[model samples]
Target: MIEFLLTLAILAGINVLLACGFNLILGYGGLVSVAQPVFYAIGAYSSALLSMKLGLPVPLAMVLGALIAAIASFGLSLPSLRVSGDYLVIASMGFQLGIIHIINNVEFTGAASGLSGIVSAIESPWRSQIYAGTIIAICAVTILAIRWLVTGPYGRAITAMRNDEEVFASLGRDAVHIKVTLFAVGSGIAGLAGGLYAHYFLFLTPDQYGIFSSATLLTMVVVGGAATVRGPVLGAIFLTVLPEAIRFLNLPIAVMAPLQGVIFTGLVILFLFVKPEGLFGSKSGGGLDAWQSRAMSSSMRKGAK
Candidate 1:
C-alpha cells in the first residue's frame, strides 16, 4: 500500500509540472498548443540516450534535455506567430503528429520498439521514498516559481496580451516576445517532467507520449483553473489519483479503462458547462479580465507619465 501510494504521489508530481507548463502558455499567455507531448518525448529521449549511451550523469542529462526542448519550442512558436485561434490549434496539432512520426521512425529513438534501461538517479531500497521526496520538492519549487511569474511584470504583460494583443502592443509591450518566451518556458517545463518520468520508469516508449497524453495534460490545466497557480496542481492530483482510485472497484480490465475515460470526459464537460472558470478561477466573465483591466490601467498611467 505504501509503495502504491508513493507511485501515485510521484505521478501526481510529474503531472503537476506538465499541467503547469501547459497553463503558462494556454492559460496565462493565451496561446493554444497541443504539442506539449512532443517536448515531453524529446526530454525523455534526450535523457535516456544521454545517460544510457553517452555515459552522462542523470542530472546533467535531464537539464540538457530540458534545454533541448526549450530550443525546439521555437520551431512551433515562430510559425504560431502567423496564426491564431483555430488556425494555431491546427498548426499545433500538426506539429504534435509530425514529432510523433519522427520519434516512431527514428532509429536512435528505438523507433517503434522503444528504449529501455534508464538508470535512476536514486538507487537503494529507499529509492521510492527518495524519488517521491525529490519530486515533491521539485513540484513545490516550480509552483512557487510559477506563482512569482504570474504576479510579476511579465505576468501582467502576458495577461494583457491574452485579453487583447492589439491593446498590449498599443501599450508598448511586444506581444511576440511575450508569447515566444512563455512558450519556451512552458515547453521546458514539459521537458523537465519528461526527464523525471523517464528516470522513474527506467524505460521509454513512443506510444507513451502521444496525442492522448497531450490531451490529458491539457485537461489538467483546464479543469484545475487555467491562469491560477494552484489550479493545475489540484487538477493533476485529482486526475492522477482518480484512475488509481477507480481500480479498487475491481472491475474487469476492459470495463475499467473505458470507465475511467468516461468519468474524465464527464468531469471535463461538467466543468466546461457549469464552471468554465475552474474551481479556483475567478467567477468573473473573462478568464483574467480583472488582471488585464489593472494592467491596462497601469500601462495607461505609464503613457501619461
Candidate 2:
C-alpha cells in the first residue's frame, strides 16, 4: 500500500513537471507549442545516454540535457516566415512525430525495444524523494515567477502581446523579444522536467513521447487553469494521482487501464463543462486549497456588494 501511494506521488510530481513546464508556453504565452513532448523526450533521452555512455551523474546529465533541449525549442519557435498559431502547432506536431520516428528506428536508444535500467535515473532510494521534492519546488517557484511577471512590466507585456501582437508592436514593446523569451523559458522547463523523468523512470522510448504526450501536457494546463500559477500543478497532481487510485481499486489488473481511461474521459468532460477556465487559473482567481479559495471568493463577492 505504501509502495502504491509512493508510486502515485512520484507520478504526480512527474506530471507536475510536464504540465507546468508546458504551461510556460501554452498557459502563459498563449502559444500553441505542440512539440513540447519532443523537448521532454529530448531531455530524457539526452540524460539517459549521457549517464549510460559517459558515466556522468544523473543530476549533471539532466541539466545539460535540459539546456540543450531549451536551445532546440528556441530555435524551433522563431517567428515563421509564414506560420503562426495553429499552423505552428501543426508544424510542431510534425516535428514531434518525426522525432519519435527517429527514436523508434535508432539503435542508440534501443530502437523499438526501448531503453532499460533507467533505475540509473534514480541513483538511490533517496534519489526519488529528492527528485520529487525538487520538481515540486520548481513548480512553486515557477508559479511565483509567473505571478511576478504577470503583475510586472514584462508579464503584462506578454499579455499585451497575447491580446494583440500588432498593437503591442505599435506600442513599442518589442513583441518579438517577448515571444522568443517565453518560448525559451517554457521549453526549458519542459526539458528540465524531462531530465528528472528520465532519471526517475530510468527508461524512455520513442513511443513514450509523441503527439499524445504533448496533448496530455496541454490538457494539464487547460484543466488545471491556464494563465495562473497554481492551475497546472493541481491538474498534474489530480490526473497523475487518479490513475493510481484506479489501479489500486481492487479491480482486475486487465480492466484497470480501461477504467482509468473512462475516468479521464469523464473528468475532462466535467471540467470542460463546469470550469473551463480551470480550478487554479488566473481567470478562475486562485490556486488549490479549497478553503482558501472559498474565503477569497467570499471576500471578493462581499467587496463587490
Candidate 3:
C-alpha cells in the first residue's frame, strides 16, 4: 500500500514539473504549444539510452538528456516565431506528431515495441521513497525557480511581449531572444521531468508521450489558471489524483480508460466555458486570452493582408 502511494506521489511530481515548465510558455508567454511532450520524450529516451547503452551514471545521463531536449526546442521555437493563434497551434501539432512518428520509426528508440530495463538512480530497498522524495524536492525547487522567474524582469518582459510584441520590440527588448529563451527553458524543464519519469519507471513507450499526454499537460495549466504561480501546481496535483481516485469506482477496465479521457476533455471544455480563469487565475487579462491571445490573432491576420 505504501509503495502504491509512493508511485502516485512520484507521478504527481512529474506532472507538476511538466505542467509548470509548460506554463512558462503557455500561461505567461502566451504561446500554445502541443509539442511539449516531444521534449519529454526526447529527455526520456535520451536519458535512458545514455544510461543503458553508454553506461553513464543515471543522474548525469538524465541531466544531459534534458539539455538535449532544450537544444531541440529551437526547432519549434524558430519556426513558431512567425506564426500565432491557430497557425501556431497547427505548427506545434505538426511538430508534435512528426516527432512521435520519427521516434516510432527510429531504431535506437526501440521503435514501437518500447524500451525497458532502464537503470534507476536509487538502488536501495527504499527506492520508491527515495525517488518520491527526490521528485518532490525537484518539484518544489522548480516551483520556486519558476515563481522567481515569472515575478522578476523576465516575467515582466514576457508580459510586455505578450501584450504587444511590436511595442516590445520597438523598445529594444529583443522579442526573438525572449521567445527562444522561454522555449528553451520551458522545454529543458520538461526534459528534466522526462528524465525523472524514465529513471523512476525504468521503461519508455512511445505511446505514453503522444498527443493525449500533451493535451493533459495543457489542461492542467488551463484548469489551474494560466499566468498564475499556484494554478499549475494545484491543477497538476488535482488532475493527477482525480484519475487515481476514479479507480475507486466499481467500473470495469475498458470503461475506466475511456472515462478518464472523457473526464479530462470535459474539464477543459467546462473550464473554458464556465470559468476560463481557472481556480487560481485572475478573472480578467490572464485567462483564456492568454492561451491564444486575440490580439496576436488580429496582428497575424493584419500582417497577412
Candidate 4:
C-alpha cells in the first residue's frame, strides 16, 4: 500500500511538471501546441541513451537531455511564427507525429521494442521514497519559478501579446523573442519531466509518449485552470488519482481503459461547456472559449484591415 501510494505521488508530480510546463506556452503565450510529448520523449531517450551508452551519470544526463529538448524546441517555435490557431495546431500535431514516427523507426532508439536499463543516480533501499521526494522538490521549484515568471514584466508582456500580438509588437516588445523564450523554457521543463520518468521507470517506449499523453497534459491544464499557478497542480493531482479511484469499482479489465477514456472525455466536455474556466481558472471564462474569442477577433480585425 505504501508502494502504491508512492507510485501515485510520483506520477502526480511528473504530471504536475508536464501541465505547468505547458501552461507557460498555451496559458501565457496563448500558443496552441500538442507536441509537448515530443520534448518529453526526447528527454527520456537522450538521458537514457547517454546513461546506457556513454556511462554518464544519470543526473548529468538528465540535465543535458533537458538542454537538448530546449534546443530542439526552436524547430517548432520558428515554424510557429507563421501559424496560429488551427494551423498551428495542425503543424504542431504533424511535428509530434513525425517525431514519433522517427523514434519508432530509428535503430538507436530501440525502434518499436523500446529502450531499458536506465541508471539511477541513487542506489538505496528507499529509492522510491527518495525519488518521490526529489520529484516533489522539483515540482515546488517549477511552480515557484513559473509563478515568479508570470507575475513580473514578462507576464505583462505575455498578456499583452496574447491579447493582441500586433499591438504588442508595435509597442517595441519583441514578439519573436517572447515566443522563442517561452517555447524553450516550457519544453525544457517537459524534458525534465521526461528525465524523471525515464529514471523512475528505467524504460522507454515510443508508445508511452503518444498523442493521448499530450492530450492528457492538456486536459490537466484545462481542467485545473490555465494561466494560473495552482491550477495545473490541482489538475495533475486530481487526474492522477482519478484513474486509481476508478479501479476500486472492480470493473472488467477490458472495460477499464475505455471507461477511463469516457470519464476523461466527459470531464473535458463538461468543463468546456459548463465551466470553461476550469475548477480554478479565472472567473472571466479563460480556457478554450477565451482562446476562440481571441482568434476570432484577430481574424475579424485582419478582415477589416
Please write out the lDDT profile of model 1 over residues 54-119, one tens digit for every residue. 999999999989989999999999989999867988899899889888889989888899887788
lDDT of 3 by residue, 170-256 (tens): 898898998898899999999999999999898888998888888888888888988888898888988898877787786998999
Compute each candidate's TM-score over C-alphas.
0.91, 0.86, 0.93, 0.94
Using TM-score, rank the candidates from best to worst: 4, 3, 1, 2
Whole-model lDDT for model 3 versus the true structure?
Answer: 0.87
Q: Distance (Å) between predicted and true CA of 286, model 3?
A: 3.1
Residue 144, candidate 2: Cα error in Å is 3.0
Candidate 4 lDDT, 1-305, residue by residue in tens:
89889989999999999999999999888999899999999988998888889999999999999999999999999989999878988899999999999999989989999986788767999999999999999999999999999999988898789878998888888999999999999999999899999999887899978888888889899888888889889998998887677877889989998998888777777777887787887767455554766677789999999
24 Cα displacement, candidate 4 (Å)? 0.3
Top TM-score prediction, candidate number? 4
lDDT for each of the candidates?
Answer: 0.85, 0.73, 0.87, 0.89
lDDT of 2 by residue, 1-305 (tens): 65556656777877777777677677666676788888888878888888889888878998888887888776577844247757888888887888779988989988888988763654566765665677667767766776687779887777667655655788777867777777777777777777777777767778778776776777777788776677788898887776666665689877887888788768877887887677766544432222234445546767978
What ranking of all candidate models by lDDT puts the best one first? 4, 3, 1, 2
Best by lDDT: 4
